[model samples]
Target: MNIPGPEPRSDGGVGAVAAAGGLHTYQLRLHAEYGPVVRFQLPGVETAVSVADPVLLEATAHIDKRPESLFAFLAPLFETGNLQVMPAGEHTPWRRLLLSVLAGRPSHERHFTQFTALATALADRWAERAGRQPVELQKDLTELSLRMICAYALGGDTADPGGIVAAFEEVLTEYLGRLYEVPDGGGREERTRRAEEALAHLRATVDRVVLAHHRGSHPDKSDLIGALVEAGERPARIRDTVMVAMLAAHHTTGVAVSWTLHLLGRHPEVAERVADELDRVLGDRPVPEYADLRRLTYLEMALKESMRLYPPGPYGARETTVALALGDYEIPAGATIFYPFWAVHMNPDYWPEPGTFMPERFTPEEAAKRPRLAYIPFGLGPRSCEGAALAMAEAQLVLAVLLKRFRFRPAPEHEVTPTERFVLWADDIRMTVSPRRTGEEAR
Candidate 1:
């Protein structure tokens, strides 16, 4: 059956996507006007099919391949290959290796003290600046997230944390900037030269860490580099995997926590409840132990709800390995399955009052009622993020530390507008931070 969409625009979809804001926003408009399965023009490619229905999403879950062309912009950062589009044969083992360490409770426990330190430091700095200025949540939190990933991926003892963070930022600014046409201080030729230099420095840093892992003879599944080394992955692939992890984990986790706090700022009642949970769980302790995460149930729900409202990575894409039946529709083989995460999240059928921020919707009782794909802050299926567990832990830890120490109020003059960039960026979330009094309520 022919899918419904707007007539092919001569401008190759640029004007349309721009008019609606971005790719995900355009997809939402499509699904709203043309129903769940709507075909639309993606700028670089021909027509793409976007499915916003959860049940339909289940049908395509088995498709493991990602369209490599769409992700080409990130290719310069990877050495071995784009793991995002690695063949199923290669990806399966690589994913297993990553998950073994990244998903492990032991790994989380091992790093908890260090992660807590990083978060506490950020919180302490914010406390000092609390009354002085509206803290830039997006900028400050993303940088913290980058540092946390560097520590997690390369270990805290690695050289020059600030330099590593700066290099990665430079690489991203040069590469991602080109895709979105975002201007930078340096000219294109100069930016490219610097980015290449930064990329080399990062790879060398990973190599140093890998060499240490090899020398220590601690190739354990509970450690990220150790697991890869133990699995006998090629040095290049190991570095590529680490790069990908840092790339995926940093901004995404940073924005997830930032958006959650932004929501709490607007919804003081819910923030009060989150604070109550923190109080009851930690009592007098300022930071949560690794075990305390599960007990921070309300806080977890709030984070999940915030993601539902503003997923860090708004959309995902997969290539059909074969012709597929999606509900009433038959999709052709080799078609691009557009996963409009924001639209699926906002689908009224699964999420009642979809636009509202209701953390209770994520309670076990309520969450059990929705389809698995109904809430995909992280993308779905086999090509889904391997760092999912770690990202959650990182976000929760950061949110706990900051929310415990300070109350975030949206700055009076700052506007928090949701625009899709890197992650579903907030342009910049500037919030007034106030040190929490010992017995302060959310007011």
Candidate 2:
């Protein structure tokens, strides 16, 4: 059988699969047929695809090590000062500081209680809405994740976040749609314009919060903004970095939530198990504390399974600075190498039933048995998501709280199809949520 790559086959066909919108359906379809490395060269765009273990690791590390030019794609979405746009060397110190305060064990533990409370509050609101017909799961998940990020990252309230979140969502979804034309239509240039406009709105809000905090007149807060202001960085860069954190931190998790809900709706068994776990661990509590998260390992596995089948950041790309040999293709220095986590995660060689939703694949023992790079929902190298821990915590909290209170079934004829952008999202998931009876609720 012929493998998927840049090479033309004996059968007359378009060279490498270049669908209308750079959709790489063929890559996922034939990943097992192909070995580890597959390079596709389009006119003016040379891209390499990798599903092999060694190639994926080396490729990720190579980009993470020297990541200045490779981040240009982000310039249109975030200002140049954004951490995602910062050169590798300059970006390192800030990342270290962030990890120390945010992603590390200490901060994660400290914030767990807060997240649990937030989760319960949100789920309570969802319960209130359970009587109001079917809810759009994608919209609900997006709002929930965005609000949490804003509260945590900006240390703000819900009063005005809705509009800002909506604007950010517009720009994100549009950019994901590949609309990059400048001046005339909505495309890359248009996305940059919208992002800047949205940033201006957010900056005004940030300025108010920052100035108030700086006056030594506000109450102490431990949210993301508080963490940044206390970190003591240059004012301008600090503002830009906060914006970067907001964009980078929330979008992936938002998509993850959407995928999680879609998967649970499709697999009632998984939802039942998660709900059962939540009930067994905690009952009648207003909110679960940080300690409860450990008991939900299966929920973590379920999230991992959802991500494996549908990772938020489906594929990552990096432009090479030097020539590289991949498979039968000789890629030049300027080529853009594509590392598709979606394809890699779904390759049957690595995952027993690549297309199924089986959380067992992520059990500690099973995970240990798999290749490290093979599981990169948070990515593999230094450039891996900084907010991964936070995302996971928030996911567990929301899932546990929501499932404990309500049971959801897929809305009639609701289709869950992935629409790709910087993150992969179920186009629009709709679910019928019913409030569980007192006794029927997670016991």
Candidate 3:
């Protein structure tokens, strides 16, 4: 079967999509021009296919192996093995273990108090700054998310939370910068040396955290690190797991919360509705409990809608381990299958007025009508995000605390642009915060 795609550029299709517009936007254009199964060019890969249609995606949903060539850039960050490149035999058990800790209701409840307190502390800071300076949504939220993950996953033994967060950011910025650069660049050697230094700093920090856990500095046996230590996992494997968890936990939730706030800021009516729900649910309380999460239906719907429009990690990819048939096209083994999540969410058939920010789109009645895979912000099938439940809990609780305390409005003359750098991030989501008037304040 023949596949439709644009002519490959002579530059080896390096930065082709990115040059057009960001990768996310370029993908929407691809599906618009060509059909759902559009062939595309990716640097360092032989053949790449982008599947936009949800129906077609089911065919390849079962393939769990990620493309090694694509994920190899992350290998240097790990010691024993790269979780991204783990084969099915190892990946299955590893993922299952992660699910046991991350997906459990008990685990979420265990960490809820610390998570809520951290979120409330940030909200309190924002309340103090209301009407003074615009809040940096992504920066603050990323730090909050990082702190929560460290507390939950590594326990409270971390002596310097700020230093650990800084090291992780340095490693990400250095490696991600090099990953996008042309391989034969002039300053490649210098950049590579800097990346190595960053990696060393991150590894040393992780080593200290792990050693503290083993020495009983953190006695919570149920914590993620403690559980692994009790399971007798290797030190290298434990380090890799912790690093990966930090990498996954930090920015994704931060960006998700950032985008949700951005959307709510633009639509004051929706923000008002969310605020109303929080007021009715929590009443005089500043923070939301685990049980309160289920009662905040409007907040949950708005978050789901936000993810549909601006998924934090905009794309997911897998290498075909065996011959696969998708729609009418036959994808050979060893081919790169790209899942353009942003494009999938924007598919018109699944979502009407996909560009419009309508929280009602996610209401239970409305959602039941659409295809299950139509809304895949966290992905689908076996390799889906294990910490998805945890992320939503964090995002919803933070949104509740922040929104109930202050209203967010887009900062004057500061434009928010979504750029892809391992995650869909807005460097500056500049928004003004004004304290919300409650019953007591109004009286």
Candidate 4:
């Protein structure tokens, strides 16, 4: 069967996607017009197949190769080649190694204090604002998550946490700003130079931690750098891992929290439920202990539902090594397979009232009735996010603190518009926060 899509244009599929406003909207429109399986041109790739059906996604799950054209921009962030686009054999070991430390209970527990302190510090600063000005959730939260990740990867002895975070911001500014356009005063060259310097500083900080591990001063079960070193990985690879970890953890987790809060502000009734749950679970504690995460069940459900609505990383891609039988169509070997996660999450077949914000959709019983791939905010298969557990822990902890102390209401003057960039973001998420004074006030 011929796959359905718009007629190919002289400019390829760029016009179609751009006219649709971005890939998220484009994929949603594509699937709606042409059904779940649509073959379309993706900017560079002459023809790519996007699979929006969760059941069909199962067959493509084993593919470990990511198409390079879409991921090439991320190459500069790595030293031992791009980890995300590495081959299946190399990626398998690397993913396993990262999961060992990243997904472990000990690792999350080990870093929970630093994480709490960072969240609290941000809350304190917001408290000082006294609701005089609306806070930019994306800006504040991403920086906080960056700090948490840096502290987690480098241990408490990091020389200058502020400088490290600023450096990473520089790197992101360059990479995300399209590398050619200068930010503020600098030319492209100057911006590139600053980003390179920042990347070098990040690598140097990781080297410092690696040296500490070699000296046996940092002995622990949750040491990422130590684990990599113990497994005889190369220095360049260790640096790349930390770099990627910082990049992946900070933005995605930060935006996940922001988008969740964005939704909660719109749906005050749901917000009250989450607040009530937090009140019952924490009992006047401003922050949650690591173990308290499980007890904050409704908060977790709200976060999950938020991610489903505005998934941090909206889509993923892979290169098919062999022919894939996707329902009525056959995807040939070496073709590009685009995973439109945003489309799947809103497929209507799986998610009832897909546009509505209802956190209870994630209650374990409700979720169990759906396909495993039906709700993948972290992605799927071997190349899926290794930091899913850690990201969830970080988002839930941050939300717990902020929601517990403050009640967020959308700034009436500002529109919280969701856009697709590297992550699902808004032009600005301006929300007013006033401290919650009482449990009854929460309800």
Note the Cα lDDT for every prediction shown: 0.88, 0.67, 0.86, 0.88
Overlapping backbone residue pairs in candidate 4 total 0
> 1-443 in candidate 3: lDDT tens per residue?
88999998877776677676677778889998997999988778899999999988988888888999888878878888789879999999889889988988898998898888989889888888999999999999988998888777766656677777777777777677767663554766776676677667767766776787778664553377766777789888888898899888889888899999999999999998999999999999888889999999999999999999999999988989888888789998999998899999999989999899999998889999987799999987778899999999999988988888888999999998888878888767999999888887852
Weakest lDDT window of 10 consecutive positions for candidate 1: 217-226
Candidate 2: stretches off by over 4 Å: 1-4, 7-26, 30-33, 42-44, 47-49, 52-62, 65-73, 76-82, 109-114, 129-132, 156-159, 170-197, 220-223, 322-332, 437-443
Reference-based TM-score, model 4: 0.96
Relative to the unseen true structure, what is the Cα RMSD of model 2?
A: 4.3
Candidate with better lDDT, 1 vs 2: 1
Cα lDDT tens digits for candidate 4, 34-60: 998998887678569999999989989
Error of 4 at 115 (Å): 0.4
- lDDT of candidate 1 over 1-443, digit per residue (tens): 78888999899889999999888788889988999899888777654899999988999988889988899988878878777788999888888888888988889889899999999998888888888898899999999999988988887687599999999999988888888988666577987899999999999988888887878843322277788888898889888988898889879999999999999999999999999899899987899998999999999999999999999999999988788988777888888988889999999989888999999998889989999999988888888888899999999999989888888899997878788877899779999999885654434
- Summing lDDT over every window of 10 consecutive residues in candidate 4, give the lowest-scoring window: 177-186
Q: Clashing residue pairs, candidate 2?
A: 36-52, 179-187, 180-187, 180-188, 181-187
- Cα lDDT tens digits, model 2, 1-443, are 22256464443223444442334455564454556666454334534445445344564455643234545445555544546645678767778877866686666665566566666766777777786877776666767777777767655443487886876676565554443322435356766677667757776777767776778655534455556688776556556766677777666766787678778888998888887777778877645677788888888889889988888887766656676655455556765666677887876667887898999898888888777678777776666778888888887777777777788888887667776645676568788888764445434
lDDT of 4 at 383: 92
Candidate 1: segments with Cα more than 4 A from true spot = 183-186, 217-222, 440-443
lDDT: worst 10-residue window of model 2: 11-20
Q: What would you estimate as the lDDT of candidate 1?
A: 0.88
